[model samples]
Target: MVRTACRPRWSAVVGKPFSAFPREVNEMIEQFFGPSAANGSTWFAPLSLWEEEGNFFVDVDLPGVAADAVEITVEKSQLKVAAERKAPEGERQYQHQERTFGRVERTLVLPESADPDSIEAELKDGVLHVKFGKRAEAQPKKIAVKST
Candidate 1:
């Protein structure tokens, strides 16, 4: 009886199946970079909401987004905020670029007693702040009577 040699099914350094790996990965893996349309990426900016002195305040961080690129509106007791930014002018080569540059729209639901006419918004140093007065709310009242 004769025994034939069986080839070893080896994997890459990362320990993945050789056949399962794509052929492009085995190649030099193009080290160049190019730009892509970032017109719809997940937003990473932080936002905060607070209420004080019969008013509601909203603050959002938009570091790279310009004031002109942002739009704010209120409809049906909800605030909508959107921002869009374009890529830089110069050539940028990125091995792993992770900057979002898309139209971002966020909906902020407000209480039914929110005053929309008095809403105000401002952007400074990449920080957006919005404030709106609250509508008058009727609360429980108690009355006391003396002996007649």
Candidate 2:
């Protein structure tokens, strides 16, 4: 006889096991308990970073975020991206919720080669694209060899 493992239906409701709920749900529970509520919750904007051609690139996911709401800054060799996604106006009950709304931010350490002054950023289609150019001395240079 062969047997297979069985899982509960609620397990896939939030793309997680039933035993573990989403962060929002956990926050709600914590708020009701009134113990860790003062700690507050932290929201982060998902991002991807890569380097190519002596340049660094970053793409941050900012769904439901306005372009004007984002703020980017570089100081002390660190790049900071901060934004907020406001909650919908009016009161309404939600059957199932996964998306989070509030202040979202991400920070990354800039490499020595990165030129903070040459950094550029743009927000399009809910994605924040950032490019960091390398300093002239950091770029590769071709050395010609000659017969002596």
Candidate 3:
């Protein structure tokens, strides 16, 4: 059964035993606490973390958000990113408001090898690209062996 915002429909699975219990329970729970409330009213932007070469990359999704609204900082082994997304002005009617607005912060604990001083961030095409350079000692090194 389909569920509406005000009313939630429930259906029981008759084919399999105990199946209806789990499905019905989950459907009811999701009605009250859905994806929109996963992070509360103020939502957090999704970010991807990966390492390439000797640099660590953090890509944050901030579509429709301005660069000036974003703030980045590094302290010890922690990297913090904060931003706010405001809703457009002069709206007429709304069906569903999924986009998040307001202040959101995400702090990531970086590796010890990451150099806090060597950090850079850039916003382009609604994406915030952050790069952190690894210390020389942390980078992979090749050693040559001479024949004895």
Q: Pick the candidate with the highest TM-score.
A: 2
TM match of model 3 to true structure: 0.68
TM-score ranking of the models = 2, 3, 1
Error of 3 at 80 (Å): 0.6
Each model's total of backbone clashes: 0, 0, 0
Candidate 3 at residue 66, lDDT?
A: 96
Q: Decide which is better by TM-score, 1 or 3.
A: 3
- Please give, for residues 27-95, the per-residue lDDT of candidate 2 as tens digits: 455556642343343445678889997899999989889998999999899998989888899997876
Instruction: Give the residue spans of candidate 2 off by over 4 A.
Output: 1-42
The local distance difference test score of model 2 is 0.77
lDDT tens readout by residue for model 1, 82-145: 8876778899877666565666666789877788888899899888999998765532246898
Name the regions of candidate 3 deviating beyond 4 angstroms: 1-41, 90-93, 145-148
lDDT of 3 at 47: 88
